[model samples]
Target: MTAGNNGTNPPEGDDPFGYLYRSENGAPSAQGQQANSPRRSYNEVRAVGDRRYGQQQRPQPDQSPSPYYAAPETQPGGGQGGSGGPGRRAAGRANQEPARRNGLLIGALAVVGAVILGVGAAFAFSDSDDDKAGADPGASESADAGQDDAPDPDDGPPEEDEERPLPQENGSSLRLENGPVVAGDVEGSRAKDGSYIHGFKEGSAALWQPEIEEDGEYTVFVGYTVPGKDMSLQVSANDASPYSARFSNYAGAEEGDWAKGWTQTFAWVELKKGTNDIRIACGDKAEQCSVAMDRIWLEKGHVKK
Candidate 1:
């Protein structure tokens, strides 16, 4: 057998362990330097590290990109780069001037538009006033003439009422008996000038009775607002006795003053001289009105209408 057939020892000048670990570029290391040529050993090829290697290390190329491998930096203003100085700020202001002027111009236009609108409105108002003044000379006079009367403004705007003569004082008087059915409104009505009783709800009224010493024929005047076209009062004297007497409104009373009227609405009835009750019911009509009497005059003789 030949020596090549047995693999007991390595080839001439070769190391079986050193074949695994070698240095790159065959550079001299820091350890095991020669005396004459200053030779270095493989242990000092690189810096020592904290390593735990079960297998032998093999040589490999460096893969990191540290500063040692980077290219040198070039100065600016040589290629695509420019000198970034105060000129950049000047260019920015030059680009913004048009926008600033546009803003100022828009503000001035708005102020001018507002002034024009105010002047137009004032002129329009003045023209309309002039036209109205020239149109009707007696417009105010006509409005006053349309009224039922032109009473002194001091007398508190003549009451809203039908045209009627003013009130006159009554001649004779009687012991006025305030009725029991008098509610608070009736007292309030009594408080009103020329208004005695007030019946605010339907089917309600103020009652009254007079003691007559000697009764033959009497004149009665009722004061109240204008009666409805067909509004009739349901009244009775002494136990609901049928007394269908047509009572006329005390003229201006219907005109709305305390509704006091001096007109006569009388009836001829013979009495035995006792409690002659008078119930003037305004309830059959609207709560507003039917009949009210501020004063009553029962004279000696039968008075005509």
Candidate 2:
């Protein structure tokens, strides 16, 4: 028999014992022996199988266009959307942000500097105030010195006593009698002539031994009384010149009868200390008037500067 006869093809009835071959239809069958067949890798087999079975491979995430991706809409400029638009605007704002931040920082620094300056100025002013608040020792010392040198109001020298008229022997010193009449047992009578008129009907008239060596302001006080009339007292020095105003007397009215005494005072009378005639009178009517004279006191002193 030849290589392939019925018997040699023999057991074609049962499937090959060791290995089985499947057709493209996945049916197990024994067929003609393949010779010099092209070998396929696993990936190539998968590709061919996918092509033959009309199956599609899913696209890789990285390889496919994303569903979220949007086509860029843009202006004519190639900047952002398609090329240049909003991207350029955002880039410009980003560039300017640093400048703005720098400006803010600089402004903050300026404010801090101003605050420091203000604090320094306040400290300087406070120092000046503190200086002013302290008392000046030099000024206090000067005031103390001045006070030490100043005169004491209460402990000063006593005022000098005024010189008084001297009492003399003889009636040459005329005594004031009733009214303007000068009457003394030793001295001759002298007339007042109403030279010094006061409001009284009675006054005093006297003559003093003048001492020209003692030239000073003299004050003479004559006290007297009159009856029934409002009276004032007056005195005159030297000759009785009607125009000579070296006379002074009490200012207001007098009280009491001639028997009762009324007293008055005369102010300053410029006089020489030599023999000078002094007359006292009443300011009543000359026709019928009289005054009772009392004591005559004289004082000599310097004029106030």
TM-score of each: 0.30, 0.28
Local accuracy by lDDT, each model = 0.46, 0.47
The most accurate candidate by TM-score is 1
| lDDT per residue (tens digit) for residues 1-305 in model 1 | 23453664442212333323434655332321221233334365565442323343433456333345332222332232224544545665778999999999999999999999999999999889878776587876787787846677788865545633322221112222233122222322322353343333455544445565555555444433333222345455566464555555544454443324433365444343666766555444453344544444344345655
* TM-score quality measure for candidate 2: 0.28
Q: Residue 31's C-alpha lDDT in candidate 2?
A: 48
